[model samples]
Target: EGSEGFSDLPCERYHLPRPMGRLGKFILPNLLLPRALSDRIGAELLHVVTPYGCAFPTLPVPQVVTIHDLSPLTFPQGSSWMQRAHFHRLLPLILRRSRAIVTHTTRVAEALSRRFPGIGGRVHVIPPGIPSLPIPAGAVPAGRPFALHVGTTEPRKGLEILLDAFREFPLDLYLVGEILDRAELEREIERRGLGGRVRLLGFLPDAQLARLYRAATFLVVASRCEGFGFPPLEAMRAGLPVVASPASAALREVLGPAVLWAPGSDAAALQEGMRRMLQSRETREHFIAAGKAWADRYGWERFCDRIERLYHAVVSGPPRGQGSSAPMRLSQRPDAPQKETPRKREIGTA
Candidate 1:
């Protein structure tokens, strides 16, 4: 879904091959590829947009990089030490040199601006957009009322907290994502005696997911933090009431008062939030309406428009520093875009 926002945009895409692991992250993109391939295009380029935070090469062209989140810094346990170390060494340089930086949420943009001083002006908060989904022609999943949580079983997602909260709750809990920490999650579920009640659907296609969303009584998002909380927006788009944790600044900012917010990591708060949504028809209807309204505003059109404007601004603006070797004119520059297959891509806009 990260690349879906650009599907409708008026720009060419170049799906380039990348190397594996450390070689791709450190050597190939940053050093080898540019020297070998950049000159293949006949015209000069206005800006090289890196969807990821770090640039692949030390290119002479202007750059616009996107930082999805600071999860490695905030939740260090979720990633490897090597990955964290790589970011620690390279992020500062990337921030300092990039012409423009894009982030999915204003909270992240603010945090990034604060972390890397003097780049506040360059930080752009262009939230991810959700495409309009036509409700599938089928019956909602038949069963007892269930609260759904859709994301990978990562520490940062706060799935453990959700399990704890659901321990005493009567309703079923449905989790829809690949469990990275499968053994750990299963152990926790067994320890809590929630084996029968909690269902792990693993990864589902869009059609199945849409059906699950429609079938759900409500959606519970207990993520501790995020670059942008898409599940809630997706839930909202499906006309589902959301019960979200207050810890997710991105969710609080994006969904606003539309969701039933549960405080901290407390199980009781989650229980209360879920209960309120289930028992109170007024509350459920209100959130459903508000959530759909809020989610509707963040359509693909608006997302593409902001991105296009940013591209134009970067292309048309004056070049940075006398030592920099950015292209002089937009017309003389040729565009080259890249894309990654979305088959199992879970992070970001997805």
Candidate 2:
């Protein structure tokens, strides 16, 4: 959900006319388009935000790819067949050809290293910064206080497990995200008899989300796995206390002691954690204070600085077959007095 600190930053975005419709999102970009397009756009370093990109025939320039998770390979239930195949078959080729790889957590990096053993040296762990969402102007959404759950309807998100724990909570459980599987989720909610207690306020605008985040009693993240747990971290940034399942190594490493962790990933453990959070005033206060301090450590400036430096390092390095003494390109130019041509990077998703 975070954009690698690229939003509003001093970089150019190349908008190749994409085909219309939902299927076109992944189709035209990866299939029809060629790596020669990068040469046409004068791309010094091609950075693919996702792993499923063409690195086979080889790009004219060095490529840097960022892989968010290995969920398709490691946890098949969360992904589609297309995703599983792409990651399993093509991802190794992409990693092999990439000059540098970027991932938010060390957990994902280690996973990649294990999958493609000798590729470890190129992996870079760069944690993303939380967005400073606009301060919502209106009062919180009306009704009973909510235990907020913010994320997509992906199966790995553990919404079903959250459902089991939610059945016991006194408060309404508000889920905020784009509904990826409406029928499945609705049926599950109805089956559990949580139709009234649970509400799916699907895809609210950022302002409304901010209001909910600020006003929620507490945040609950019951994920089976997470490459990086954004909702828990985002909740902390929004000044909401969090009770999360320790399902992801990334979450445990990044948010230790800042959030109340469930004893296990099961519904019973989640319920216990929720009960403790809801019933106690001291636990809430402690996490609220600690969360803010931890969340503040991930500011936009530091994130952007690290990313930009990485970009410079990747682009300035010699070509794959060349010696280290090769000259630096214009992308490597230091930001300076008005005389030099300004450096720019064109961004496009594959």
Candidate 3:
């Protein structure tokens, strides 16, 4: 069962409880039992997992829950009421019952610890791995420079700020994900008279996305909060520099000093930062080198190895004489605490 589909992995492999219509919700529950039975028969049920925000049937076997982010809790306005309710009511129960808790970054781990002090010791930070894709070999085109922005359009993504910044620059802007507020964003673009320069290439395929990364001058991450910033690492893998807000702890932990930091929801600061990055050759080269080095640390093999070890530790116990893996070094910067603003929207920008 483990090796059944090794040669042909599906493109969009979403887990159940996805955003679908009434029929999907009705049929999904029925499909689970038979699938779970089949998994049990094949002895692969142990690998079946659920996230912390869902309801699970009572079973004798142990379970693990991965908490990707707490955005719904931190920025409730970004989520639907039902989604927020589910996380608030069901997540704590799930956490208490889980044999272990997995998170992507240390920032999230710390947040989880602070929120639910009970699971402080058991929570683990197993960062997400980037799967290597074939990079297209060629010299990137000149006179067509643009900044890449990935992720859904939401108040938390700081898209408004990014758009404002791009308007100030001569270069073009490429938005590469689904827009949740299509009408509002389009209205904003029209209002700002940025129709010609701003392009929305919604949800490109993986191959195309890789090409986009290679083509881009740099990637911009203006998110107000994130459990882990995947696009920055993806940008790094493509040897692209990253310009990001310091609002996300995961970005700070992962990218460190490699990424150019701007204040989230500050249009003036974002505009200044973007202009500075585009103008400075030395700054761009420094970030490119630093980003590539940072991205190299997170390969799928290393991620899988850490996960497998964690599974063994949970099933049996921690390795003999091994202690906790929490980071020993803390940030010495005076501005670190000032950057931890909760949630604020930057208008007229990305």
Q: Please provide, for model 1 over 1-350, each residue's C-alpha lDDT reduced to its tens digit, 9 standing for 90 to 100.
A: 23555444344344445666655656544664445335643223323334334353366556677888888887888878876886677777766667777888889888886766777777778886886555778676577878899998888898878998898887899999878867777789999999989888899888788888898899998888788888789889899999988987876888888889975557778888888888999999999999989898787777766765776677677766422434322232225543742221111110
Clashing pairs in 2: none
Give the C-alpha lDDT of model 2. 0.78
Model 3 TM-score, 2 decimals: 0.79
- Candidate 2 local lDDT, 1-350, one digit each (tens): 24545555456666566667655645543553454455456767667777756546546667778988888988898888878877877777777777778898899989888887777767788887887777878666577888999999898888889998877678888899978978888899989889988888998877888888898999998876678777788889888999999887877877878999999998999999988888899999999999989998777777667767777777786554311223223244376677755556665543
Cα lDDT, all candidates = 0.73, 0.78, 0.69
List the candidates' TM-scores in order: 0.84, 0.88, 0.79
Candidate 2: TM-score?
0.88
Please give the ranking of all candidate structures by TM-score, highest first, separated by commas: 2, 1, 3
C-alpha displacement of 119 in model 2, angstroms? Answer: 0.5
Ranked by lDDT, top first? 2, 1, 3
Task: Give the top-scoring candidate (TM-score).
Answer: 2
Q: Look at candidate 2 and tell me the lDDT of residue 327.
A: 26
Error of 2 at 115 (Å): 1.0
| Number of the top lDDT candidate | 2
Q: Kindly report which residue stretches of model 2 are placed more than 4 angstroms away from their true locations once superposed.
A: 1-8, 19-39, 320-338, 348-350
